[model samples]
Target: MNLIFHVRSERRVTFHPYSSLNDYIDHACCFHCRDGDWWLAKSLLTGDEGFIPCTFVAKAHSLEVERWFFKDLSRRETERLLVAPANKPGSFLIRESETTKGALSLSIRDLVAEEGDVVKHYKIRCLDNGGYYISPSITFSTLQELVKYYTRTADGLCQRLNAPCKAMLPQQPWAQDEWEIPRSTLKMMERLGAGQFGEVWMGYYKGRQKVAIKTLKEGTMEPAAFLQEANLMKKLKHDRLVHLHAVVTMEPILIVTEFMCNGCLLDFLKTEEGRKLKIPKLIDMSGQVAEGMAYIEGKNYIHRDLRAANILVNEMLHCKIADFGLARIIETEYKAQEGAKFPIKWTAPEAINYGTFTIKSDVWSFGILLTEIVTYGRIPYPGMTNPEVIRQLDQFYRMPCPEGCPEQLYDLMMGCWKEKPEERPTFEHLQHTLNDFFIATEGAYEMQP
Candidate 1:
């Protein structure tokens, strides 16, 4: 059997007499060729076969000089160099009469190669899995932007890229009909914030109901894992936990939940209201978070990222634990890859060095969160980078009490940050300690005001 391989010209070269059929060799031309440097090649484009220098052509390679299409090249020249004929699937071409090189003005005959009288041309905006134009007006400014958009939003690409987990995820009632929210009911408002795999938006549901819409930011998150998280979230319900409302199972996946009027706990503390925040209010907030975490602990769930940022607050100064994507449900210690990105300043020494995550490690993060509350969202380690913080922790260097921080609360923070994971106080213990403080101060606090 003759092996078929494509030949791409590295530079302009003339075909030898044995290969030439009165046709000149052009750049970016794809042709099937036999093995050998000076072998005969058959043009897939014009049905011409001739001997061409193998050194001049790259075998079955992508267009490396695509950057040149935007520089010093006319639209016609770009088409000639990079754009394959419409007959070729997965070929990119500029739209007719388009002078500016915008993603919206280009079309692709994606790998499907469907049969039709006129080949279907797909714009960058309409390339979603559902092929439904959610926003026809949105267009990428450049080719890189278009590439990025596809890399994240393409469901097929994301699945193929992300490695499958070794352990089988337990099946849950994730596909329940009542969990699905209609896409039309969600009116997206201002974007709240964004992370590696998702973006949060403050949205309105059913016209008047407020909700926080968490949407996957294209290719960042694995769909299976995302679904598992949603299912886990639905099963969990607590007063100090963020409430999940519904999930939109459409092209752009959305996880809708109750809107926290005050946003992230850390960000809120950094604002003017946080600066003037009373000790009683701070204690109340910390107690609430500890209560939520204790509930998670009871369920054998380890909240890996238990920092102030992952905690949300409401208008009434009520705090709730949020962002459980990194949280794990395990009986013992759970270890992850060593090089994975983790919150350095907030993590325990064991978690940072050995990749071990447990309830105790979460207690360590709770200590950091307490410091954040005391300092009104000031960073745990002042003027130290993550690496420096790690080095200091290794040397048993702990942060001193924040200014105006109560000595009793500071003692609890230190207990949570013990060198040995086993030595750290449990979330249940921490909650009781905070509750005692509040009870002792409530009469004084109330009488003073």
Candidate 2:
């Protein structure tokens, strides 16, 4: 079938004869090419013909294209999104049922709901005849049709579907060539660290350029799964993120990335030089991480593990987010395996209690990271055992501001630790806030001199 796809982002054809055509007609729909990542398409506005990257578009008719369709969204996440201060009573979205396979659920925000229950969900049933319905008497041929009907009249629903839950436009993956590197070109050097899966070593790419090579231990993880990390890294290209250079999938699988000479942020912060850095410099470091996370969030990806230990620092004190083994695409459902060990103090309550992870959970971890930053790498909730930390969190207890931490910075951290996930500021918001704070603090320090 010749499936239709819509361009989610504008792409400027900078090279070749196609550059002569109009800059990729905005909001254009196109057909996929038989081979490669190119698409054979015409602009919906100007009918201009050109080739576009397949990664720049999304399936036209897929539910994922709709802002309100949040596939695999958990019940708690839906509640949090709908209860946000900006949403109105009739805002709604459709998500795959968490309890039922091959089934969908409709969640709506209701102004009249009791105090504790502002969002309500209803099961959407599908018939063997390929029709969908929330009530037996209101079957529709497509989900779009059902939504259209509800938009005009509440009928059996709690309220009319006035608007889709606010969300960013979908982001497609990057189109790139194979990244496999010849094993003969690399010269392994000193070991950096060891983990449960494998060890990381300092290596030289092409015998001169520095790089970090992460090797996969045999029988530790499936090769395909390990390669998936490399594939994910390919799409995440940002200056503040550890850049992936190449991979060796041969006998000993290796992932090569840009080397951070200073090593992980946690260890660096505890060093004598690290402790001597002023608060403004620490804020600048934290802002760099926020900037990287903002990019990841915009692309609809979640870094499930966001802690100081996972951040790497360069010789210049610049920080970058590293370690993607626990990252996931927002659209996919993720559940922690039972009995699996998690970083209790660094994890959010919902994730620890129910195995649900979302971008909000990452925000919670960032709050804990702030405590580490101000204390020069002190552990979060020190003197408390894991079980004790959980018990305190259940009582709504939060970590206090570290000594010498600025009042404004502590307040921002508290905002990140809000009990409701929706109340946490997004990475983009946090980035802007921290950037502004850094500038103000730097100015104050200069004035004192």
Candidate 3:
């Protein structure tokens, strides 16, 4: 059977049967037939025949074949891409409307308006004739034709299409080069610690770069499920989140990430150096975690496990969110599988009762994490079991503020632990508030000295 595929990465044909043919570059298209783990294909662009690795390309058809089509982009992500510096006015992209199933949204960046660069979105309607139209009066048999027509004339749009928004390539795991590193390149050193699925080790990449390598314990989890975190990490890149360097998909399934010199926030807080940290410094650390969570939330992701143990600190005391094994993209109807374990103390009431996790649930966990930070790694609801904590929460009882914790900071934590999920403050708001608090606290501390 004939199949169509889109080349996601640059591939040099070094294997037999097609070694002399041209290399397949990013965004290239090909028609191919499956040959074991390879694609015996003819390039649509150059008509060159080759046996390409299955991992080098992804099966694509219809609207997905278009560079401007972003199948899974959310409205917020669409706006962010359009307004990016690399994309100029008239840059546009087509995405499936989040609110309307099967409908498409045409988002375009316009020239600077009074409020600055404005992004306008138009809905593309489909007629009974199978033609597409934005204004109903102008119709095209195919979406590609419509894009071509719009590219030439604005007609009744904010601006004529100039170019597709600069593609954010990192969202696709295969788009990254040298991401599947050879096992020989990594030199495993001393064991750092162990977790639910594996042991983490302090390793050296190429004998120079320090990295944290986590090895999967056999029979602990399915390989695909174990690599889910790596796949998610590949898409998310932020200063406040631990960076994924590479992964070994072979047996042992190693995940290598940027090494945090100071280790986990929980352990760090209990250390001598951590105990000496001032109130302003602690606030600054909390703000950093909030900033990272804000970025993750904005990207439509939820960190199901948002406890201090999952937060890591570098030598500079900069905190980053880590351990994304339990994280997932926010979806309409998501519930953890039956028998799946979750930290009850760090979980929200709704999440504990229904296994339903959302960004708001993460906020509740953040409040528990705040208690940990304030009390230097004290367990939440001390002297109470998980069931007791749940019972107390049902009675509308919240954790009392830790001793020496600032009143304003404690108030922020309480706001995060609201009974209703919708009543909780968003990570974005938390980040801004914490940042402002840190600035004020730092100024007052300086004045005292």
Which of the two candidates, 1 or 2, achieves a greater lDDT against the reference?
A: 2
| lDDT of candidates 1 onward, in order | 0.65, 0.76, 0.79
Error of 2 at 287 (Å): 0.7
Candidate 1 local lDDT, residue 145 = 53
What CA root-mean-square deviation does each model show from the true structure?
26.2, 17.2, 14.0
lDDT of 3 by residue, 54-116 (tens): 545666655665668888887655765676556879999999988889998888888644445
**Tens digit of per-residue lDDT, candidate 1, span 1-449:** 34344443333334433445322334334445445335566665666666665433443433322321222333322322222221233334333234334333333333322321112233334454424231354445454454545545543221111110111111111123547778998899999898876789998876756689988766555667677777877777787899777887655688888788789998999888666666755776788889899999999998899999989976556688988777777878788766789889999999889899999999999999999998889988989999999899989999988998989999999999899999999999988788567445323111100
lDDT per residue (tens digit) for residues 1-449 in model 2: 55556554444553222433244323646553534555556665666666655545666666666667787677645755675545778999999987778888888887652332267678888989999988787789999998999999988677799998754221112224437878987899999999876889999876756789988787755767767766876789886888777788775788888888789989888999777666756776788789999998888888888999889986556688998867867675467778867799999999999998888888999989988988999999999999999999999999988999999999999999999999999999999898778444322111100
Which candidate ranks first by lDDT, i.e. highest? Answer: 3
Model 3 residue 325 CA deviation (Å) reads 1.0
Point out the higher-scoring one by TM-score: 1 or 2: 2
Tell me each candidate's TM-score: 0.58, 0.58, 0.59
TM-score of 3: 0.59
- Checking candidate 3 for backbone clashes, the offending pairs are none
